[model samples]
Target: MTQPEPLPSAAATPAPAEPPSRPSLPSLPGLPDLPDSHVDAVELSGPRFQTEPAQVYRELRQRHGPVAPVLLHGGVPAWLVLGYREVLQVTQDAALFSRDSSLWRLWSAIPEDWPLRPLIGEKQESILFTVGEVHRKRADAVNEALFGIDPFALRDRSERIADTLIDGFCERGSSDLIAEYARLLPALVLAYFFGFSDSEADEVTHSINDMMDGAETAVESQAAFYTACRELVAAKREHPGADATSRLISRSPTGSEEEIVQDLMVMFAAAHQPTAEWIGNTLRLMLTDERFALSLSGGRRSVGWAMNEVLWEDTPSQNVAGRWPTRDTVLGGQRLHAGDLLVLGFAAANTDPQVRPDPAVSTQGNSAFLSFGHGEHGCPMTGRESAETIARAGIEALLDRLPDVDLAVPAQDLLWRPSPWMRGLSALPVRFTPGPRTLG
Candidate 1:
């Protein structure tokens, strides 16, 4: 693959070769007057993102090159890093492009009730918003907590969880796998690891699902999550255990309870929804694609292939809110000013024509996809492994129990959730043979 041009340093002077002039950016309603640099900036929402994001990214690349200017919710201006190389440049260089949301320049203009505020996360001390050496320490704490988990034990517990969930609907022979299985398994397992009682886990799981889905209860759900985490931190402090929350507390002795709570929130928020979506999307692939369906009988390796293909083709984490430049810089030949927000386009980068010349090609055993991100802020290795173990075990257990499972609805009739930041099915209805209860 051809290498992308070297990015000009954020503090360095621009090269003598100037970009060619283009027509002024088309105006949108209620947008404040700004520099004319953003020509034909696209809104990150709407039907295009929900229905056809890959095509949307391709069109944006064709029109505006790799680093395209885009409008977020409530018309917040930001750049979407759409190229594989551009995303790498942004993610790899923490000094130039920081994950600190407090550096964002538009905070004063943003409304109090701005929906995207939770995601942009300005002034939050969570590990997600931490940078530099402090971030490394927090990340280390998270890694230790997650790494302490035994993969074999996790896989076995996940199998039991999957069986328990399937028990609810296994006798019916028809179910919405997204709601009944995929979405619940990760929450239950994570909750157990965090030491939440069954009742607390149920409540926290509902709040998490509501927040991740961007539902009407999102604000309340966000508050609920914090409250739950704070309580967990307080409880774990007095009586330490082998649970992840207790481990995090013991690991970060110097960190504040608030910071620890926030980091726990980050772990739960990061792991739960994406893992659930991975399970849902992988199941969708297996149910729809004949190549995978044929392998359902005895082909266990195909399960891994389907998981990897989903990461490449329909990553759950489509866009991340994102790296902010420390100073003016030129990336992918486009000028970006100081404090500008850059949404990491994971799905777009995975499909960039430069690396993936053929979309139809198999990506099995290729782990270069940026679905979990890259560099210092990438998903911790331990976290990724736990998610994979949970997902793979969930899928394998379901297949083992129901070998003849098939889609109850037409493939064309399936609908995707309308969230620009996430790509997942709204519901995956399927039919299978009714079996005897396993846990009884």
Candidate 2:
């Protein structure tokens, strides 16, 4: 992958803070450099990442300051940047800390069957991996396609989909929001946005849910998604419509069908998983936390508050696949050699005591949280708005339909999905009064 150039808008945006000046551990004289070994490296996974990650990040900060040496899947050495300032610095300076993962030093040692490879290794041609002028064009094309979506129409589509999904289980008086609603709504709406027919939308929803679940069917589900994307692009090319797929195909600079397909897959995965998690996490917070109790009665104000709070406290994107140093440098008092992977610890940074002194206070209107990320590589504004629209609309629709809904299981019994990278519920079982169905 080519190295990422600074965003074209860099000149207008304020400069990021300089890298922290704290000195790292001094290399002993006459010792050969160890590229892939760190004596104090902590494992970035296990029960702690799922259940008590905030506490774990806090402990890591105490042990290793802002940037801590950590082991990724398969004991791959990396740095987890946990400070707000450090994360900002790393994300902002894309030139120094490049987005190209090909720079990673341990690829020669990384097994072909490594689980994380599908995410970070494969799909190198996608927009997520592209940089420089090429990346800018692709990013612009994507934003333009998404921006063309009318907000009111998007909201209506979301509402209609939410109603249709709710209709299936509304009479049953109980449903697992994670499996049934939260996971499916975004995929269905996105399918519609990309010009999938009703049947294709259903297929997409099923496949995306399976793919994200990391189940035995994940590989097959991924293949199905790619096949569907190729078919969709082909259909769009032969007969363009007022849809995102058509817009993307028409505007893409390369005009390469494969490039467009890869980008669509990237967009689909990125848009669906996080938006689903956002809805689930926000609903979980509102249902469990007293602060959001009023929102249950269809209070629009508190719905927005609950959603904003989730972005700060339990962002769906907990950590992000990160930047690699172009050259040896010190960051947050830790030595980073060229090719060292640095995971952007968004969840940890949000809770950093320097910026957020009191976690108990409300973050209702604050937009500084790195939940949507920061700098040139941050989640694009159109992407953020579309996700927010989908999430807020989904939550509001559920509340409007089931005003008296309550958690079917005890608050303690509601388990989170055991993944290190995302913060979302495994199941949000809720029961409500069975009422006559109405099309929303």
- What are the runs in model 2 whose C-alpha is more than 4 Å off? 1-37
In candidate 1 the C-alpha lDDT for residue 169 amounts to 92
C-alpha lDDT (0 to 100) for residue 189 of candidate 2: 94
- The residue pairs that clash in candidate 2, if any, are none
User: Candidate 1, overall lDDT?
Assistant: 0.86
lDDT, candidate 2, residue 133? 82
Off by over 4 Å in 1: 1-31
Cα lDDT tens digits, model 2, 1-440, are 22212111222234324332221333333333444436656567666677777877876776678998876665566789999999999988888988887888767676677777866744478888776788889999998889888999999999999999899889999999998899999999999998999999899888888888887998999899999999999999999999999999999999999999988988898999999999999999989988788889755669888888888888999988878898999999987889888899999999998999877787877988999888877899999999999999999999998888899999999888878798999899999998667874
Clashing residue pairs, backbone N/CA/C < 3 A, model 1: none
RMSD of each: 6.8, 8.5
For model 1, residues 183-301, the per-residue Cα lDDT tens digits are: 99999899988889888998999999988877888889989989999998999999988899998998884759988998999899899999999999999999899889876777475
Lowest summed lDDT across 10 adjacent residues in model 1 is found at 1-10
Model 2: lDDT equals 0.84
